[model samples]
Structure formats: C-alpha cells, structure tokens
Target chain A: MSGIELKNVTKRYKENKFEITALENVSVQVKAGEFVAIVGPSGSGKSTFLSIAGALLKPTEGSIMINNQNITDFDEKQLSSVRLNQIGFILQTANLIPYLTVLDQLLIVKKMQGTVTKEDKAFALELLKDLGLENKEKKYPNECSGGERQRVAIARSFMNDPDIILADEPTSSLDTDRGHEVVQQMAEQVKTRNKAAIMVTHDERMLSYCDRVYRIVDGKLSEEVRTQEV
Target chain B: MGLALKELLYSKGRFIMIGLIIVLISWLVFILSGLGTGLSTLSTGVLSEAEYSGIVLEEGSEFSLSKSSVNRSLTEKVSEQEGVTDTTPMSIFRNSVRKEGAEDAEDKITDIVLIGLEPDSFMEPNIIKGEAWSNSDENQVIADESLENDGYKIGDTVVLDNTDKELTIVGFTENKTLYHQSALYLPMENFQNLRPSSPDDADVEETVSGIVVQGTDVNLETFLEDEENVEYGTKEETIEGIPGYVAENATIMLMLWFLMIISAFILGVFFYVLTNQKTNQFGVLKAIGGSNGFIIRSVISQVFILSLVSILVGIGLTYLTVLALPESMPFYLESNMVIIYSLVLLAISVLSSLFSVAKITKIDPLTALGRAE
Candidate 1:
C-alpha cells in the first residue's frame, strides 16, 4: 500500500467486432526500497502492465492502489494529480524535452508542481553530480550523449521524490556498457532512497541490476527466479 | 509560459518567419485603409469644409451639387423654418483659369471649380495669406494655394474660360479642392455672369445651385416633409452621395475586410500545423501529469506574445512608410483608425489560437506511453 499494488488487473481493446485482451487478471506488488524489472518480448503486454501500474492506463476489470488509495476510478484530472505527486515516468529513448538543458530537464518537473525552491535547485544539482553529469548541466539533450541523456532523465524522475517510479525501456537506445551503467545508477538510487521502481525492458543483460524480475508472455505475468546477486 | 518563451527564443528562425508574414499582412491593410480615406477626401474636401448642418438640393438632382438648382425664394423659406438659424445660397461650377495674357491652350489652362458664396457667409474661405474679398465684386476671387504652382500671386489677373472677364486674385487659401480640381472662391453675382442662365428661365436673380443651412437640432425628415421638391441631407450623407463615392468606398473596404479575414485563417492554419507537428510532444507532457489547462495556457501565451510583438513591428513598418511617402500623394491614416484595426487584428489572432488549444486537449496520454496500437 505504501508503494504500488495491482489486484486482478485486466486491459482489453475492442477493434471493430473482435475484442483483444492485452492484459488478463494480472496482479503485482512492489514495496518501498525494491527494484523490480519486467522483461518480455515485443507485444507480450509488458508495456500494458507498466502503464496500468503507473496509472497512465485504466484497468478494464480491476483496481489499482497506490499508497492505499484506490485509483482505478479516479477521473483524468485526479489521475494526473496522482501521477504528478506519487508516480514518476522514465519513458523510452531518454525522453528529455529537446529545448531543455540537462539541469532544466530536472528543474522542469519541480516547476510543473509549482514547488521550485533554492533547495530544490541544490538537490537537482546534487543529483546530477551523483549521476556523473555535473559538468553537463547546461548541455541540451541534443548536445549530450545517449548515456548522459538517460542519466538526466533518471535525475528528472527523482526530482519530485515520488513514491513510485515507472521506467519503460530506459536502456533501449544505449550501448551495452552504457546501458548497464545507467541501470546501476538507477538501482543505487532506488535502494539508497527507499523508493519503489518498476522497469520494463527486453534486455536480459540489465536484469542482474534489479532485485526482482518478472516475465509477461501473451497477456499473462509470471515472476522469474533470480540466479545472480544484485 | 516559461516553456513557451524558451522555445520561441531557441527557435528564432521559425518564429521570425511567422512574424514577417504578420508584418506583410498588417502593412497591406494599413496602406489600403489610408488610400481609401484619401480617395474619399479628394472627392468631398470642399463640401466637408462647408461644415453645414444640412444641405438642400432639388429632389431629382441625385445629390450632385453641380446639377442642383434652387431659387432665391426657397433660400428665404428655409431660413424661416423652425430651428433654421442661418442659410447660405452657393453655386459650384467647373471652369478653367489661365494667366491673363496667356493663350487658351491646354498647357496654359488649369481646371478649377468656381465656388460662389456670399462675401461673409459660412462658406467663405479661411484666407491664409492676403485679404478676403470685401464685397461681391465681379472681378475679384480667392484662389486655392495650388494655384501658386501656376505663377499666380496676389493682385494677379486670371481670365475666366468662355468669358472675356478677367478676375484679380485677392487672397490665397489652403489646399481646397472638389472632385480632384482646385477651387476658386467667387461672389454669387460673378459666378452667375460667367455662366449662361438656365435655358428655361431668363431671370438671373432667380438662380442658385443649392442652399447650405446651419441650425440646432435640424431634423432632416421634417425638413424634407416641409419642402415639396427638395431633398435634405447631413454633410456626411451629402459627401457619401457624390458620384462613385459609395461604390469606391465599398469596394476598397470589402477587399480590406476580406484580407483581414484571410489573415486570420492563415494564422489559424499556421498555428494548427505547428500544434500538429508537436502532438507527440504534447502527448508526452500529458502522460507525465501535465494538465490540459497547463498545456493550453502555454499555447495561448505563446500566441499572445507572438501577436503583440509582430503587430507592433507591423505598425512600426507602417509608420516608416508614412514618413517615406511623398507630400503630393493622397494617403491619410488616422491614429484612432489604426488603433482600432490593431485591436481587431489582435482579437482575431487570439481567437485563431483557440484551434491549437482545442487540439492539445484531445491528445491522449496513452499514445505517448506506447500502450495504444
């Protein structure tokens, strides 16, 4: 309840006359201070589950509870508030706004919430330093390398200190070495800050950095046994 | 708001192109408006100078001062009517003038409108130099300042066309013209002697073209009902009734209004396309918990800023044109008219930006998350 919990979540799409189910009776829980990874092939409903957990998509036939509040029936405006205050999204391909520099990328989230302060600026600067992007603060997304862009995006996710973090394919556009480095930074932040994170990826090389891993196959979700140390 | 400004500053080249388009459209509108006013002024300058409350013309004269004929008896009758404080009988006839000794050739002749009025009537010229005529003498007239270009000076004699009588120019007034011809002020008697009497009447004392009346609270309808064969109209209405006046104004105004409407649509389409190009960006913002109002405010603020800056630049360009224009050219732009035009343009721009705002409201966050197929 302090993090994110899904109960019998199901998502279906109706196209003309045929009804297609993207997720069926999927239930998952991620506690505080936990790093979870969802791995599956394309079109396997991993993105659907992550979207529902992040409150971006509504479950067709179940409930989602974040911090003990039932969010399945929340209106769009209320859902937006929930997403802003409780959830953080790290989209695929390091989705930093093109015109914003690395530091502005993190500051913009605080600005959106109308809570920007001097302390917030210092915290953003400190987060960039922790991600090894201290000197890249003034560089735009186009100026930064792929790995640096991803690091700025990770820093942005922690800007608001939300209770839940949902990252979708955060390493899809990076090289293997840079991808592993980015995942390790995110793992360290999640553990050190006592926050819950759910990452959806298809790369098996990034799974060792996550404490728990799940695989979704054809609208069904199943947990995978961990064979390596975090 | 910050986001909008930052994006505009970063994308200076794109926004500058849009600003230049706005400038071109606004410049066209302002210049056309000035010309339209100038054309009306050219046709009605003398009549407007009369500043009379009402003008009475024969019913069938079609509001043309030259064609209107009124007897001296009717002028007296109008002065006795209720609310009629003063009445002046005047005549406007087209004639040519030349230096007294010059031959009657095309190059030596200048077309002029002979305006005959009482010596001290309200229609008397405001003499800027020399002295006004002291009496209704047959050999004295006041020439418009344009005649100075023809080498005429005070006390100089100019021969009237179709008559051997030569009139001495006693004074010069400001640029006063009618139907694009320079005006010459003369006494009513002198005006009558120069032209042939009406073919149907032999009495020269019964001749006059129209009556200009000044009074308080003069009702045009009541005046028309009291008189049998005369039409009464205010000065503005009379000017509008000039030949080709209504049609010319209507045509130019129609084109001006159409251009403004087209500019509004152009702005709408431009903003719409820009918004469409950023649909994916808006979607991502929405998915990240940005409210619809937030995105809408940003877009409207961008439009407001763009319109303000571009319209100011457009007005500045128009001012530059006014400064560069030649003095002889017929172009007049009033400040109030320009301000009204700018306000209407800004309103249209704000209205057009709503199209982009509505598009932002419909963007689904699901699409941005890659969850929807």
Candidate 2:
C-alpha cells in the first residue's frame, strides 16, 4: 500500500544573498487510494512541498515515511532507488525524451533500473491501453498532441508500478476541457489501482475531481476534507 | 541502452554535425600524418633499408651521410676493429650528367648524388637490374630507377660534368635515391676518379668521403673518432644525423600532437554545449532516480560512438588518398606507420572526450528542475 506520512517537515532555500522559507512545519498524511490535490497560488510553496514528498528535494528537517520506511535519512543513491522503486513523478510539462518512441520511453526507464521483463512490457501495454494510447506506442513524443503527450507522461509515471504518484501541475498547458479530462483520468486510475496520488496545481477548476483538496499560502497548508456530492 | 541510441537517432542534425566535425578533424590528422611519413621516407630512402648497423661519422658532426667525410685510411682503421667484417670506401658528389650523343640536348644534365660504392658492398640490396660496378675505365654506373624513368638506358653514356669522363649506365635500383635527387652507384676506384668533385691536393688516392662498415663486435665508431680521426654512427643515430630529419619530424609531430589537443577541446566544447542544453532533462531524470553514473555513462557512450565512426571514416579516407597517390609522388604507406598513427588518433579522440566528462560531472542535477527555458 502507498501511504505517505509527513511529520513536522520544514524546508528553506538558503542562498549567499538571502533566505526564503518554502515550507514551514508542514504535517500531512495521505492514505493509500487517496486522490489528494494541493492547491495554491504562485510562490505558495506547493511545488516545494510536493518536491520534498517525492524525494526530489530533501527537507531541511523532517521524516518522510512512505509505506512505513523513513526516507529522509537515505543517501543520494538510496533516495534515487526509492524514487525508482516506490515513487512516480509527473511534471507540468510532459518532459518526455523526444528521441524515444512512446513504447521506448517506458522501456528506457525500465532499462535504467536494470532489466525489463516480459511482464513489464505487458503491464506497459496495459497502461497504454488504459490511457487510450495503445495505438501510439511506436510514435515519438514530438508526433503526439499535447493531451496525448500528457497521457503518455502519465503512463510513463506508472510504468514502474510505483505505490505513490506525485504530479506537479500535470495539465497546466492544456485547455480547460483537456485539463479536466487529464485530471479525471488520473483520478480514475488512482482509485482503480488503489494507489496514493498527490497533485500540486494552481488551477482551482480541476480540484473537484480529487478526493481531498488542500491550499498552501505563505509557507503553510490549510486542508479541506470534503466529498464531491454532485 | 536503446534510449541513448534512440536519442542520437532522433536529433540527426545535431549528431550529424558533431560527426561531420569529427570526420573532418580525423581526415586532417590522417592526411598530415601520411604526408609527414612520406616526406620522412623520401629524406631517408637510401639509409632506411641499409644493411649497415652504423655509419662511422666524425664525432660532434652534424651531417652523417650527406656532409660527413673520412679518409680511405680511416676505412682501413674501421675494418681493423674486432666486429668489423668488412669496410667499403664511399664517396658522394653532386654533378649533372648528359647523354653523350643527344643531338636535341639543350644541356640535358640532371644533378645526381654519385655514391661510389664497392663492387661487393653489403649496402646494395635492392639492385633491380644489371650487375654491380667493376674496376673499369669504360664508365659503369648503377643509376636509381628514377634516372631510368628520365630516359637513361643501360648502354647510355652519361658525361660527368666538369670532366671528360663519360660513364655508361650498367644497372638500376629501386628507391635508392636520396632526398629529391637520383643516386648513381659506381665502383669505389672508378667513383673516386670519375665523379666530378674538387680534387684532394693531399693524398688524393687515400682520400674518401665516407666508409660503410659491416660487423658489430667492436666500437668502430670510437676507433674512428680516436684512432683514425673519423666520424662514426649507428644506423638510427645516422638517421637522426640526416639533414632535416630531426627538425622536420619534430615540427610535423608537434603539429599533429597539437591538432589532437585541439580535437579534445572541440569535442569538449561540443559536449559542454550539448549537456548544457539538456540540463533540464538531466534534472528531470535525476529527480526520477537516474544516477549520476548513468548519465555519465550515456554521455560517454555517445562520444565513444561518435569517435569510433569518425576515426573509421578518417582512416578510410586516408587509405583512399594513399592508394590514389602517384607512385612517383614519394608518398609511402607503411602498415606499422598506419597502425601507430591510427592509435595516436584514437588516443587523441578519447582524450578529447574526457573534457566532456569533466563538464558533465560538474553539472548539478538539481539545475535540471530549476527554471529552464
């Protein structure tokens, strides 16, 4: 099960000229199979919080327990291994390697981890099929539309069968309809797979699709535990 | 593995440009190295394949074969050494020769290095046609094949300039020419009498320009310098003593080595720019669990592939040039030389790629996720 527990996490950017507190004493937990959306305006440190949670950036002080193991004390290699084996990150941009075909994109990540099994290919195909991109596996990122590229990015995120998926502005560049569809697809997948999903977004209109929504303003998070009754 | 290759294939323009740069650089190195070897062979044709281990020249002497000289008595002294199997007197002088019966001759005289060798000398290994020289007044000369190409037959009488002596070409040898001029071989006694040079006022018969000694037991060179007051040298030392051998080789080698360094810098710069452009992707990969070693291996593999392709193309082009070269152009293609040069080129290419690694290793993976255009 992919459950994330953050207790008293704080992060600060200390430069030679100035210091900026990005996240201050932030504590949160998301159960497995939860679709959590982190909403914030610009400079609200939502990216910082999501980055710390994804093990992309280590917190200045805190323990990140994912599936009961504390990841904050892990070394660089260990952290990378954690990210590879246990976490999947999706960014605002699709960030697909232009040179790799859609099928090869997932294959490369798997190859980087060491070897790709027959089952891995089957699961990749199944993921692509679920994302409505089964036909575009041989195409390159440059040949795909924005929405399709996003979907491929999402598919790549789950290629390793990660327990936790962290998405930062996954549909920031898409139209309202495409953004809504991308969020809806991600929500449906998170619930269907029973995997925890934490998304950082500035788009308020997309928050309704998530199981829970939280807002960050001025280095603090304000949680909103509500169900969509519509 | 597949992704790295796919990346290279996708960006045809960038990789091709890099490959083209590699090809052009490698081609330049190959051509220059070939020319350097060709010129070196040309300068040392007579001695490169000689049987003598050493040529005894005067100590502190700059010129060994070309300008160094010793007396006939000195040749006898060199022969007296324990290792001395035999010693032959050789006299070299430059003079123009003209065919005696050429009616259309507008002074059709060609300057040649007349090598007065013994009839039984060990140095005459490549005599292609006709017999060696003999003690005769009828003027017997073994001309290099180049002279034969210039229209001199075995029976053709060549009039030595500044003398009434006319020599008949008795034979021809291949690649025996020194520098750019053809060499003519004659008997020690005849070459002394026939080849046009300033007469030795003192002990004329005993005076000889140099001596080729065969055998290895004794240091005949020390004996030549001390006892006979003559210069001596080993074959390798003699080669270094040849005019323009060391200087020319040093200049060419310096240029080649410098070009290799430049290749490193060029590759370094190319990879630096490339890695800089892909910093964001690198960060994204790093964020998603790509280790630094993985990134490094991928970049290095790309460079290795590029260098390998370029070197192959460069060597192929060099082979074509060497093959297409005119036989008389003095360009020689030695297999050992090719191997050595290619290894050197490859070493330079690999060294050049290190600059890329140096730049890549310094790249902060965190920069990949930071504000990128």
TM value for model 1: 0.86
Q: Which 10 consecutive positions of candidate 1 chain B have the poorest summed lDDT?
A: B364-373
lDDT of 1 by residue, A1-230 (tens): 58999999999999999998999898889999999999899999988898889888898999999998899999999998888788888888777788777888888788778867999999999999999998899998899999998888888888889999889999988999999999999999998888899999999999998889999998999999766675
Q: Each candidate's chain A: what TM-score? A: 0.97, 0.96
Query: What is the per-residue lDDT of model 2 for residues B1-373, given as tens digits with 9 covering 90 to 100?
Result: 4556777888989999988888888888878877887677767767776777677665456546667666677766677787878777777777778888653557578888788877777876366887666546766888888787787888788877778578888888877766667888887777777644455566666666667777765475467446545666777887787777889889989998898788878877887788778877777777777777787788777777777787788879878887887666766566676677667766665666676666665665455345445
Q: What lDDT tens digits, residue by residue, belong to model 1 across residues B117-152?
A: 877898888999898887565468998876775677
**Model 2 C-alpha lDDT versus the unseen true structure:** 0.78
Shift in Å, residue B358, candidate 1: 3.1
- lDDT by residue (A1-230, candidate 2, tens digit) is 35898989999998887988999999988888998989998898987898789887789987899998999988878888988888887766788777888887787678779888898898889989998898899998889998988888888888888889989888888999989888899888888988888999999988888878888997898898565543
Q: Score candidate 2 by DockQ.
A: 0.52
Best by DockQ: 2
